[model samples]
Target: MTQKRLTPTQFRNQLLAVMDKKHHWAWPQFAGSAISKAQLKIHFQQEYGVYVRDFPVLLARIHGTNPPMDVRRKLAENIFEEDTGKLSLGKSHPELFLTMMAGLGFQNGAFGNLTLLPASRRYRTWLDQATLNRIWLVGTAVMTIFVEGSINDRQELLHPSKARSKREIESHIKRHPLVRFHGLSPAYMDLSRAHQLVENGHRHDAYDMVVNHTTTRQDQETILTALRKSLRLWLVYRDGIARACRLTP
Candidate 1:
């Protein structure tokens, strides 16, 4: 039997629903915990550096002939901001957070390496391929729509809680000069900014992948499955980070 095809919007909405559910289940477990925050900061610091280093490579892939000039420029700007911001974090925070994690008896390779898990590796690989193929808009959708939305939903889940957890969160947020300075507040704010920018049609070039492609039932299903798997994997990573930090109940 042939499967019915979904529009891009339909595929996106289905992925969003799955991400929302996972975020609801995972955020509260980590948000307020001091240990969790510490671990998260460490994780973020590691990922941030790796992302910065790879930004140029990702850009090179996107800049090849045949990609729309406007799309290339917009993605270049986004990558610049992201990488430069992260570089600033590394400069200010002298403590090598990932190295510290390794010292703490965490799985040295898994926690130390930026793209340790299958999901993360898949997400990065997809981004590279999408950019190289000049389908970056689809890549942007996956990152901003699905990934950022998932993070925002998780942050919302962390909103209410009074305990050592809450205190720890407050303290970390207050003390981390880098977070406030760099505008790394709750994940919602980041995602919201990206969503608004996309909605305003500022970066339609990035969305060209999904827009120009010939739609088919199989394509729609494949995209949807990739999105769902990416989200679920990240959620699991969040949970593992929390457990590693001893934040789980």
Candidate 2:
């Protein structure tokens, strides 16, 4: 008998389990005092070459391109509210990206030259094909469910003060003009609060549960593959907008 395909939620849960397990192993390899605000700022300026303040404009430019109405509208709202409003902490400190990038050790110029990772490339290529073929909703699913969902997770992790020095970080983020506007949005706040609940529930020790439940190398690979697929789907999302705008050469 053929096995039943998992629902999206079920699939996501499985993927999270794998990530949680990986996080335990990966965290130690990457963690250090080097993941500091000052280092993050230096890394961002030298490597990414784009400040957090500029992110909204980039997003706006992409969103402004004519696309399917729903996709355009969602991107517009998310970009505007995120870049301009209370959540706009990204714009204010600009260093947050540095902090994040530093944590991931993604500062190498070599990384910039790459279009996408092996897993992400396939997913993006698929999305581009789907979008060009007019499978618009499929493209949107790649964006809203996976790409945006990942950002939401990262934001939740960063927002709450896990460190004793969180107040310093919060102050820097809060003082930014864009972040001020971000906080004003009720929808954004609501979504943030909900995500916070999830993050809070997943204690560091929860990795034990994740490992025990997943139980096998095959299961671990399956979850990793799914995450990679989701990331690739996000590239399709970006390209879809580009296509809609007739921006692609």
lDDT of 2 by residue, 1-249 (tens): 645655444544564543333222222211333233343333233223321334444445445445556557555655655444444343322333433443444453533443433433454445444333332333333333333343334333335435324454445445432235322223223323322323342332222222333434555555446455655444454343333323433
- Estimate, for each residue in 1-249, the C-alpha lDDT of model 1 and write its tens digit: 997876656654454466566453434443433333366555554354334346545554544544466556665655544444342232211123333333334443544445444434545565555445444444555554454344333333335222234345455545443344333444213322222223233223323444345277776665566566656655665555455455645
User: In model 1, where is the ten-residue run with the lowest total lDDT?
Assistant: 87-96
Error (Å) of candidate 1 at residue 38 is 4.5
Candidate 2's TM-score reads: 0.34
Runs in model 2 lying further than 4 Å from the true structure: 1-8, 14-31, 34-73, 86-226, 229-249
Alpha carbon lDDT of each predicted model: 0.46, 0.39
lDDT of 2 at 116: 38
Q: Using alpha carbons, what is the TM-score of model 1?
A: 0.51
Q: Which candidate has the highest lDDT of all? A: 1
